[model samples]
Target chain A: MNNYSTFGTALHRLAILCYVLFALFPLFWLLKVSVTPNDLLYSEGVRMWPSRMSFEHFRFVLAHSAFPVFFRNSMIVAGATAVIVTLLASLSGYALSRFTFRGKYWLVALMLLTQMFPLVMLVAPIFKMLSPLGLTNSLTGLVVVYTAFNIPFATFLMQSFFDGIPKELEEAAKIDGATQFMAFRQIVLPLTLPGIAATLGFVFTAAWSELLFALMLISGNSAATFPVGLLTFVSKFSVDFGQMMAAGVLALIPACLFFLFIQRYLVQGLTAGAVKG
Target chain B: MVFDATAGFPESRRRSLVDRITRHAEPYLYTAPALILIVTIMLAPLVLGLSYAFRDVHLLNPFSGGYVGLDHFRTLYDDDNFYRALRNTLWWTGASVLLQFVFGLILALLLDRPFAGRAIAQALVFLPWAVPTFLTGLNWAWLFNPVIGPLPHWLYALGLMNEPANILSNPQLAMWGPIIANVWWGIPFFAITLLAALQAIPRDLYEAAAIDGAGAFRRFTSITLPFLAPTIAITVLLRTVWISNFADLIIVMTSGGPADRTQIVASYIFTQAFRALDFGYASAIALVLLVLLLAYSMLIVMLRQVLMDRA
Candidate 1:
């Protein structure tokens, strides 16, 4: 029976391996297309490795194309949104998780209500509202829209994080003659590092890749993000798969680096060994 | 502040009053940033959009438009395009969320047990979630390119279709194509959430089942499932709300195109305001969409509560 179970475990391991490969194939394909020399792209006939690989597309995208500007714009928008949304969400999440006020339930109900609407529905009205203020063509406008869209979800995220922390810690701090602000800043915020990191990463990635609002709000190259930059690969006639794939690969670095930086916080449990078993 | 507010009261009154006020006030202060932003950015726009629904305004007459009081809604109700957008939006949300959750759960379950190379496997499975949506959409676009795409080329080679075809140009299939991409993009979220929940479940229950001579299927149903119910339900609720509001995927992949066949409420509303310059009517349509969204969310919350109670 033990031997049979060992066999079963091995089979399970194999199954997991297959599943993982399947899940990652698209990413593998992304890397493949990004590196395959354009001359050999079609000639290679679905070969996993091209006879020759080139960084020429990346070189052109970085040096010759407007991709660098798009990259800079994306970083600014995403970074600002992440910081702004995380700050707001941490505060709001704390409120939702801890408080009982006159309109607490209704406030939550309203926030949830805001999330239900397809944001596309608000696009025109938002543009109309922003256009007159000369905010439509600016990165600030994109950041504002992304922050608005991300905060509700990020708030929920933060609230759950705060919820995971013990209220006893804050209570103990208050008894020690700490103000609410002091207790939160000194005690609670440190414990919520994991949650803060998660929120930051979530909002950062969200703002980074946001295409719809960027496409609609930003009219020119000055404010355009990488997603809109990818669209430039498609003119009226044919799509440039090689350069587009290369650009897609390049656009991935910031998101990858952001995750790498945050992965520690993403997995860590700041509340670990805090409370008694 | 609470102590100050209660300092005027008698000794007995002061303690209770201050405690009460502080208990109530703390949450507000903690959540003030989120509240202020949500109110100003999200709620304000919602209110502003609703007001636009009542006006007879065009793009040129943003502030000077006359209040028409539901005329735009009436036009929306009478419009065939609205119905099509409504139906497509429903289909997009329903199909995308259901498939994503189902596939995600399956993947999560398959990967739940500790095994060799589990960490690497988990990372690879979660890769799609880390990659940006724009890149995924762009990559999928390349994969769907008829002449150049591997899918059509392989299909043609296998005699599945007559020629390399532009799937996005087909009115009927464009929405589904984007839905597929969206589902692929979202599956990792479901997988991660469910996996977290699954990991939290105690191993003792499975041990109890093993002692009872329960097979894998029996253990899953009897021990694993009932425990994971709340997490699964919440995951479904979150995914449904999110998928329903998905405008980005459609924007990148289809743009509600090939003769408005893929026009979900979000994309269609965008066209009205940004492309068509119909601000008043667009706002009216947005209002309707918001109401429907609220109704759906309420249903999910209520359903979740009912299920939690039962479980």
Candidate 2:
């Protein structure tokens, strides 16, 4: 029995190691190519690591290319979307959690329908709608679209988090002469900070990663998000693998940071949602 | 109480009516912004998009907004690429979902065991899910590039290929490239959800099973599988719909290239709208996909209901 348990432990550890390696390998490769000197890139082809590493690609991408502008644009759009979505989602989520009202069923159903159908379907119509408003080719346009796109999921997430908290906290405040909104603002919102953080991170990463809409809406490099810019860069400078990889690495940072922060709560939140449903 | 001189109602009745109105309006007030945005931004566009299917709406052609009933659908029916895209959608969604689910279940099972450094392991393994889909596509595309990436070289070394070649450009093998990238990116989602489900299963059930001389496999089959069934069903169903509509990786990595071998319906719709700039045809394709997905979802729900009844 002792030998058998030892064998099991070894197998388990080996399996875990494989998964970790598989998960990290592509990222590792991305980083590897990013740091490899242009001189050695072709000569040392398929190497796990180059003979010498350099930050020349990163420097070039940051300084010479339009990537910095793209990065800033992405940050602005994602940040704005995250803030707007979280704020709207919190209020609506609070309503969903605390109140039973008319149109509630339809509201939830409408959101679910949005998730089911393809957002690609809306691309042309939205372009038509926003074009007349002069919203195309603008970061503000991207933010607006992303905020709307992310609100349903974020609201569902926030609602799940709100559901986890006791209703008594708000109810007690309400009894103590606080309006329902006041109770929510002063009592409930403060308590769901973790949920708020998770929602922010989730929305930020989502907005940051959005591609098709960003591609369709924004026309030029000045307003291009990271994904669109990188794509165009790939097409324009197909030879600069090192620089493109460097840009890819830069794009990975904020998203990975946010993801690392929120991933711990992800399972807990989902379990809460599953149980609530 | 002050008297209401302006209206026929008394002061107390007016105050009560005001309170009632406020109480009734509170939830709507809270939800109104999100509702309005959803209507204008999402719902309205969705309705317009549906209408676009029956109209002649080209992005570049300003004069092409005339009603052309069934013209786009008729064109879609005749388009061989659309048919090919439909077939490819089935293959892509099926392979990606199946592979992701299997590997995800295994990963979740492995992580469920108490092991040293599990926290860091969990974080590292789940990191891929964080990589932006476009970056994931680019990263994988580069990895398959024979000149820079090691994958082709490794495959060649293993006698799996004739030469180190970029699989993304090979029509027969291009679909696999996106599918593989998809599996890598999607596995963590399934793992996370399944892991949550696994944790929710009663530990005492395993203990009881073991106490009754049930082996590990037996306990897993009797306890874990049964406990995970509902979660698996729901996640798989939702993921199927989501993945079918997901065109990011394919768009980025291959762009449905090499004679459109990787052109699933979603990507096909995107190609029509973005590349071809034919909004009408794109909407028509999208409508078909939406109907198909709804049918799939309805079928799954009914199947689950029938299974529940039988049980």
Clashing pairs in 1: A91-B31, A92-B31
DockQ of the candidate models in sequence: 0.51, 0.82
User: Stretches of candidate 1 above 4 Å error?
Assistant: A1-11, A95-101, A167-177, A233-238, A260-277, B1-30, B60-64, B298-311
Query: B158-200 in candidate 2: lDDT tens per residue?
Result: 9999999998898889999999999999999999999989988
Chain B TM-score of model 1, please?
0.86
lDDT of 1 by residue, A1-277 (tens): 8999989877877767776776667767777887887788887766777788888778877888888999898989999999998987888787777766778888788777777666666666677677888889999888888888898899888888888889999999989988777888899999999779878988998888887778778887888888887775554224456676788888888787876665434323321312211
Provide the TM-score for each candidate, comma-separated.
0.87, 0.97
Highest TM-score, which number?
2
Worst lDDT run of 10 residues, candidate 2 chain B, spans B1-10
Scored by lDDT, the top model is: 2
**After superposition, which runs of candidate 2 have C-alpha atoms over 4 Å from their true positions?**
A272-277, B1-15
Q: At residue B144, what lDDT does model 2 achieve?
A: 95
